[model samples]
Target: MSKVQAPELKKYMDKLLFVNLQGHRKVSGYLRGFDIFLNLVLDEAREEGTADKVECGTVVIRGNSVTSMELLAAR
Candidate 1:
């Protein structure tokens, strides 16, 4: 499979993104910034749990720990 390039994420800037991390953790937030390594900075981040969402103001996710990312509709 082709690798995800930084340029491909440009369109998602300032948009909501749902991120799947290793170990079944899931989070969603507005895209703030990123790097070639795929490390991401998200604003107003929130951890999604089975029953409720936990607020995480801002988070920087390590690239290697990311499993997948999905673009979400604007709120």
Candidate 2:
């Protein structure tokens, strides 16, 4: 599998992103910032489940918990 580098992630700044976390949790938000460790700061974040979406405002996601991330179309 291809790896995502820091520079590559830069392009997605301020864009919407869908992130899959461990334990099947999912979240989506606009990319705000990230660190070398891949820890992410999301603006207007929300936790999404099968039946509901919970508003999270701004959140900081630990890099280790992230399983995958995908860019999403503008809302």
Which candidate ranks first by lDDT, i.e. highest?
A: 1
Q: Give the runs in model 2 whose Cα sits over 4 Å from its true position.
A: 1-7
* lDDT (Cα, tens digit) per residue for candidate 2, span 1-75: 987566357888999999999999999999999987789999999999999999999999999999999999665
Note the residue pairs that clash in candidate 1.
none
lDDT of 1 by residue, 1-75 (tens): 997666468888899999999999999999999999899999999999999999999999998999999999675
Top candidate, metric TM-score: 1
Measured over all alpha carbons after superposition, the RMSD of each candidate to the real structure, in angstroms, is: 3.4, 4.0
Candidate 1 lands at a TM-score of 0.88
| Model 1 ranges off by over 4 Å | 1-7
